[model samples]
Target chain A: MPIQAITPDYHGEVRDRLENFHGNQLVYVGWDRHLLFCSAVAFPLAPDTRFAQLRDEAMAGVFGLHPEWAQVDWGRVSWLLDGEPFEPMLDRPLNEQGIGHKSLLRMQTPDLKGFQSAGV
Target chain B: MAAKKLNIKDKYRLLTRDLDWEFSYQDRKEAFPYEEFEGIKITDWSKWEDPFRLTMDAYWKYQAEKEKKLYAIFDAFAQNNGHLNISDPRYANALKIFLTGVSPLEYQAFQGFAHTGRQFGGVGARIACQMQSIDELRHVQTQIHAMSHYNKFFDGFQDWSHMHDRVWYLSVPKSFFDDARSAGPFEYLVAISFSFEYVLTNLLFVPFMSGAAYNGDMATVTFGFSAQSDEARHMTLGLEVIKFLLEQHEDNVPIVQKWIDKWFWRGTRLLSIVAMMMDYMLPNKVMSWKEAWEVYFEEAGGSLFKDLARYGIRMPKYAETTEKEKEHVSHQAWWIFYNYGQAAGFHTWIPTDKELDWLSEKYPETFDKYYRPRWELARQMEAEGKRFYNPGLPQLCNCCQIPMGFTEMDDPTQIAYRQTVYNGERYHFCSDGCHDIFVDEPEKYVQSWLPVHQIFQGNCGGPGVEDVLRDYYRMNVGADNLDIKGSPDEQRWNAWKGVA
Candidate 1:
């Protein structure tokens, strides 16, 4: 399984500084004690790349912040893709038509069995 | 090339050109991630209402106006001896951290939106992302201009862009945001846009303004307050996301529920610091962690989560624990700052007896037992004029990255421990997820170069508090917070706020 990442188009030596952290390390930044964001720089050859997967999984995490992806230019974006560079869709950005919003991940498949609600 | 200037309304029309395209590669099902969670039924994505209704034009128009207002104030603050207008510089330390750690994140949000604007599938989402993409960039630029005054007064700030990369505590936020940016578009929205903006924005902005109001930092307060007004709109976007997702498909319910859980925990864990800052850090104060929790999470998110329960999302998984743990996390983060502020980029001092009484009232259950006995001991040490730093590295939580102040849920006081053998050496964590991340790849997380440990290693200024504070973080002998003047950003605040 290859690493999938969406590096944003940001400048400044800050990104360069992240690259300076040795191989495969988690770095955190905060506003006072509140953690504003987090990421781990990992090498692919390193085993058990769940962080890689979790990182990819975070894409759907910001659903409301960005409900549509087609309006902006995606070409300029850059992020570590599995420690190398691999865009989600190399030729086609993920936001184009034909991708139904419902077609995303299988969110709640109606278990009717497993999960239990509290106030019931 | 300067993207040709067009009115924001016309700007949308220009960008909306050649609007039709075909999706041929993968089935629609394989594309978006959170289609179904519990039982959400989505009849329409078009129904999603951006409360901002912000086309690029109105966005820029209002945005430009906002900046114009900021600049008028900015020029005056800089010219009118505004730095002298404040109560003390201790108040500015909070602003310094904001400039370093948070302002950069605003820019990061802008970048996330730029990527999201291009990656999302719907026109509404794309436009919204583009709007946010632009708004966040404006925020970053404005905040930097506002706080640049401190460049003349503070030390560590000058190198923050450099420090955010290599610094230890910074990894918490860097990894958190990058986690969202690398994930699918919807998850990014849920994590960064929704949970952070809608549910928790007030937690961040409210205190900063109050802190400013408390301190004589009127300019800082004014800018922060003006900016937070925009946050109301962002929060709407967040609320809209959860609502729209739950309404979309039954399948979306469980998925959105999972997101609510994952994001809620992630955001809450990160905000432990905010809890501390709000309750303890400011020289003056506002509501306590308990009070803010009651209003924001319990009243707002607490109820919001229940409403979503109608859609089967249930409150965030960590809700029960978070509500309980606030007692501890709030005290711990502040104590860390209060105890270790010498090594950090900021300053901390022993809480006055008055402040301690407030903490006991605010935190109630935990403060007297778990934290204060030790704080009193420290106060004794300081009275004896002897401060204490542990001789060696105390264990660090692999996930949250604080020295493992965490314990099992049932017994909040027990030190939670999980360990693994890495390179034939033992590593530790307070939770399973952190242990998993560390064990999965030790090379990635090890050598976090925590600020306290750096001083111990002699990698920072020799060994003493003075040396470390002055050399590394750019503090001086007399410049520490305790020695500062005029009511710790509180007395002047009363003058400015008109409330005694």
Candidate 2:
């Protein structure tokens, strides 16, 4: 996937330097493959939020991304970068992990195959 | 008394063509500067034929007659207390949605068409737009005048002009027309006159008008009929523009094709609201959105595209997905409104027992399997006095500006999510179709006035929902809300029926 390839060495480099970072990031939090309503949810994140907090808020519509009937195991929920999974340091603030603003994330079932090559 | 009469066709030809002269005082390039930048070639402007052969005199006479008839009905409806004759108080919510979401679009079309009427390079095309501009103005006026009877007793109708500009849900229609309005003249014609009017007019007009008729809304039905008569001419203009452009030059084909692709997808996304209004909002429904889609789009539009195929035109890229979406869009859209109706100017409610049964019957495959359970949960919550509402703002799609609530294709359990990065900032779309539009014109869409984002940025009056709704959106609490048992209109309706 494009995201994983762009950040293959993500853990060693950005993850190490993330503790001091403080900036906002916009993200998409989605679950399930069948989009009964729309494709995904979008939220602009605050600098102080931990991944756990962000995850909880997404579930509760804090960032305004409420999908009815969506259920995800909060702990197991992974953030997708370019449709590929990234192991987010859940306890850490997003900026601490160098996940800067405008980051795209999808919290889907871990084993679901990503990105079908559908023609537009 | 015995004077020879001129043939009507010959007279039309003489009046339309013989009147135009080469610009003597003004430079042609300076006068019509906007049309050619999109690279659409039109070597011979005279090749543009208005099949309807409409001229100002005929248009004035026809439209004036229609207006006279429509207003006479409007007057009678009001004088006879026609609001009391509607199917239900809930039925006014459908008109509320229409007035709040759609009538402003007619006004916007008036402006867009007025621009093309002034700016297009061809006299025939310009005249067509000028006529359509007046028609659109008439539509907005008649729709408002017709709804004025309801507005006298209803809540949502009073604030549409202002609400359409600032309300979150209304941003969907506003933004779509704004996107079209921002384009060059040729693109505007293709976006609205061609794609919207010709290809998708039936889906928008038929259900609402038919529902109006079914619901004993004579005023709306009358206005709808009058507007529809004008729509026939608009549709002809749309068809003629496509053919005229295609036949102009070989190089124009690809440009027109791209425009067709962009606009067809845009138009479909905008019409999703209408789908919900048809299927769910109207208490006395005329037809399901899926059935309407099958008849108007898949069947009729399919044949029209086949004819256009000879000219190297094809259907929109996301035609298959759009077809798939018909089964679910109305359901999903209504669910969103049901959950978030409090924040809106119009009221929304869960479908009644008979209405739910109608949905189940209409959507045999997906309704029970996918939507019914969630609605059941909502029903349970309401029974327990919880009455669910999305307590927070919804994440709107970057393209359509609608809440991100659609499910994946053939998979109602999951969200259909797509994203693309441009200039290091990631943009999110609710579908591949919307994503494709963004990629094609990232510069244009990236600047979208996304309502949810604007709210978060403190640009929407203030940081809180109260300020946003009252100060910015101007939504009056009990009146323009979905407390079904508590609405003033509902109480008024009850008193009118002697139930209060």
Candidate 3:
């Protein structure tokens, strides 16, 4: 396993550190501590300091943190589902009949390599 | 020697249609098998006319040129420090997975097209199939050869042929295409040519090529764009197949409608992965899945389906399902990428705030409210010096290898998990049909090749994630390939952009 599992507490900490460390830039955060990683790339794996156990917790999902699914506050910005500029369109129907913005903006960023190997 | 340019207009004289010799020896029914299986009747074989009307001579000339261009790229990249030029080996993870999971389908297309060449009763259809067969093979070869440059540096490429057969998530596409290839030639055309080619071509080719354009993957961009030019031809074939079938006899309408319904859902479910890739994976996302689907499926396909009303064909059966999931494919695919990235040869990291803001603007409905909180909480965790990961094994959807986090269409809030108990073992499935398939034949499915399972089986470079990264991905530990690789296009891009 290339990663260690972490509790929600530690997972939360890592997310915070990832943001602050990079400021605004995208950076890596995982359940492993391996600074020995090569530093020559555009994006370097964030140093695994706080969760030293992550490197060993591979299948355990970084200490098995965040068990529940990522919850969505649907009513909050439900109108965004309507295909129009925000301020005026959040109130539009959500895939109400045919064309709506909410149905169009669904997005994902899969780790190129992670996706392939997961089904093993 | 440069082949003479043959005018496409003069196809009949060149094709030797005169050689058909009027089928003197054999009965027509024996020659054509399964024509009546669907109860469709064809009065005239001469009625069908290929839209492109490409002759063999014109076909090979352009094809040979495409190969010549591709091969030159291979030679240049290999001779130079192509591997050295990558922004980082981590970026290769995308390519690695792409080769293993998607490249094989190109070959499948070859087989399907080849079968099409022979099975098609008409000369025009047969010739069209012959052309497509060769093109598909070329796609597979070029993809393999171009990726060979990474072989010395990466490990996953070495195992794709093996992975494609055994992986679980791979089954989604594998089963989809397999289902089509197993069906009649007409069905194959409907499944791939129409459902996939016309309905979702933009989702597949556009993002891949456009993303390459944005990320500075010149070779990939060029190759992708080149291949897509052929896709336009395939799209035309797809459109005509449906239109021709429907127009031939009123009977074909129902069969065509059934196929449209069945295959549309199948294709949409399969594309969920690509949707995720576009919305999240691409550093420079173009349009979100929800947006693209709305335009492509709803606006375009929707309009087409509406137009079909006059012809007696109704809307896609699972149109509701597709419409419902459109808002969530990107959301789900990204989360899956983040959580299950360990076994993956590629790297997974969080999106930036700016990108999140982009998501907010793009998905005005669910951005800051539901999705934002997850990121916000993650941001808070990061602020406290932490990164999150799921605590336990995700409940796998029996149908799709994706986790059971996706819920029923009408209610996106609930996690959807449908189960079917067999003789002794209880099999978990993502939906009813997937359960039905598994129930029908369990052994065929148990032998799936999921990447995560492979990691546990020690099929990868051994237990360490870091080890897998180095061996499987040839990951530079942390890097993305961009201008440094100097894709032929990138070199030109800089020269044109007037940058030194």
Candidate 4:
């Protein structure tokens, strides 16, 4: 339903527009079933930043603390982009792969069922 | 013959209801412009019942008496060194959360009730709102005075008003009140008075006040006792408002129901902070968050909805979801705080062994299976000279403004992520309730000053987390945040107790 308001044309200014981030867009990454990290970690990344740089450089710092981080094979890990299954071209920039601002990327490790299968 | 003396009820009617003059020179629609915009139909203003009958003179006298008693207790608590009498220094962290997150909300309630008091067409509701407005003002003042003694010795209590506007976690309570205040007058009453004060106020007050009494904090407990009568009046006003709206016109039922649904969900999400305080922060336990929900919400709220059934009102949407969520929300909330301790205003710690055992016993079904191992790992990491803190900022829900840390109730392990694209931008929510609220009023939520997004956009003070925490949030840095185990608060408590 449309909002019941005093005025008919009640348009609010969106505060977190992509332009507000100084050329970088917000991207969220969640390791599926890994409750240890609590929520998805949000990162500000340029559209031209390659997927490999995100995978190798940024993700290691966020997900490396888990005991199972080292054992997971990136090639075999399945991925979901904004809730739909997707395959990212590793060498390509994020925008080319259709990952936009505030897009969520969920990575699932099939065999590594999070530390004793408890999801932590 | 002398004029007959007036009784309390006659005096109340003479002073309050009789004082409202009819609009002889101006249009009634012009006088109350916002009444029709929200789609509520009021057939007659005269149908509104006076919720509380206290006239101005009586109201002032009653409040002044409560103030005298309350301030006397506050003075004695300070002179007696009450800070030293708490069950544990960790109990102080709960007070920090209350002072920063909850006290400002009382001020917002004051502003909301004051504005609504002027906008209402019914004089009875207007007077009721006016009295509640003053009560809210007094509540905030008394709350701050009660907690002022803690500010001298505590780290996080120093810059609370500044931090409430800038901090990441404090935005949860801020946005809740902001959403209600910006709404129309009738919606504001249903959102705050009925949904929050009537339905969920017990979940907040009972635990915090009882916890204060159990933990030996006389100042907070006295303030709680002083505010008790006012809260009862506010709650009675809430019930009267709902019943009056429902009985006045049949068209008003669906609108009021929608407000109840939206605000009840918002109230539960905001109370996630209190859930953590009850289960983990208190040195002496009151009851588990799950148990409190059963007694206060399921039992008490169940009876309330049953009474409203004749008006075609049903239980609030997502109440079933809230029932399943109570077991896990406290654990999940504390875990998020523990992970981001460095950025928070209050200190966090791994729960002591006795506390862990207590949690295990309280949550028999899920604790050992899911949460116990995580705490064990944190404890092991601490012992091995490696204290873990999440380096990255958490993604926040667009509606609630809380970090999207809550997980699916059934799965318990998978994070519950919900999103929708509106006007070419993606918005996220922690649950369906929050998502539905945004979908209903995307314009209102779109303007949210989400702290994480602001930090990443360079709109917060600086680029780094520490810069934002120290400069933007005005936190005392090393003194205010991080683990409580080795904190200056703990050390001071130990010294006061003469422990080497």
Best by lDDT: 4
Give the higher-lDDT candidate: 1 or 2.
2
Cα lDDT tens digits for candidate 2, B96-200: 889999899999999999987888777777777888898899899999999999988888888899999988889999999998887778889899988999999
Local accuracy of candidate 4 as per-residue lDDT tens digits, B1-500: 86598887788789899979978999988999988888889888888888887898899999999999999999999999999999999999999999999999999999999999999888888999999999999999999999999987877899888988889999999999999999999999999999999999999999999999999999999999999999999999999999999998899988999999999999999999999999999999999998999999999999999999999999999999998998899999999999999999999999989999999999999889989988987887788888889888899999999999998888899899999999989999999999999999888888999999998888887868999999999998999999997899989888999987
TM-score of chain A of each: 0.21, 0.53, 0.16, 0.95
Error of 3 at B368 (Å): 2.6
* Predicted complex 1: CAPRI docking category: incorrect
Off by over 4 Å in 2: A1-25, A31-44, A56-82, A108-120, B1-14
**Cα lDDT tens digits for candidate 3, A1-120:** 111112222111121112332322211122111101100001112233222221223312332343221322223322221123232223333223232110122111122111112210
| Candidates, ranked, DockQ | 4, 2, 3, 1
lDDT of 1: 0.57
Q: Which whole-number lDDT from 0 to 100 does residue B241 have in model 3?
A: 79
Candidate 1: C-alpha RMSD to true structure equals 17.4
- Higher-ranked by TM-score: 1 or 4: 4
TM-score of each: 0.67, 0.89, 0.68, 0.98
Runs of candidate 4 with Cα error greater than 4 angstroms are: B1-6
Stretches of candidate 3 exceeding 4 Å from the true structure: A1-120, B1-23, B27-30, B38-40, B74-91, B152-155, B376-395, B398-401, B419-428, B431-500
Q: Candidate 1: where are CA atoms >4 Å away?
A: A1-120, B1-47, B407-412, B418-428, B431-500
Tell me the chain A TM-score of model 3: 0.16
Q: After superposition, how far is residue B266 of candidate 1 from its true place, in Å?
A: 1.6
Fnat of all models, as shown: 0.01, 0.19, 0.03, 0.83
Candidate 1: tens digits of C-alpha lDDT, residues A20-115: 333322221111111110111111111122333423333323211121222223444343221233333433422331221101111111111111
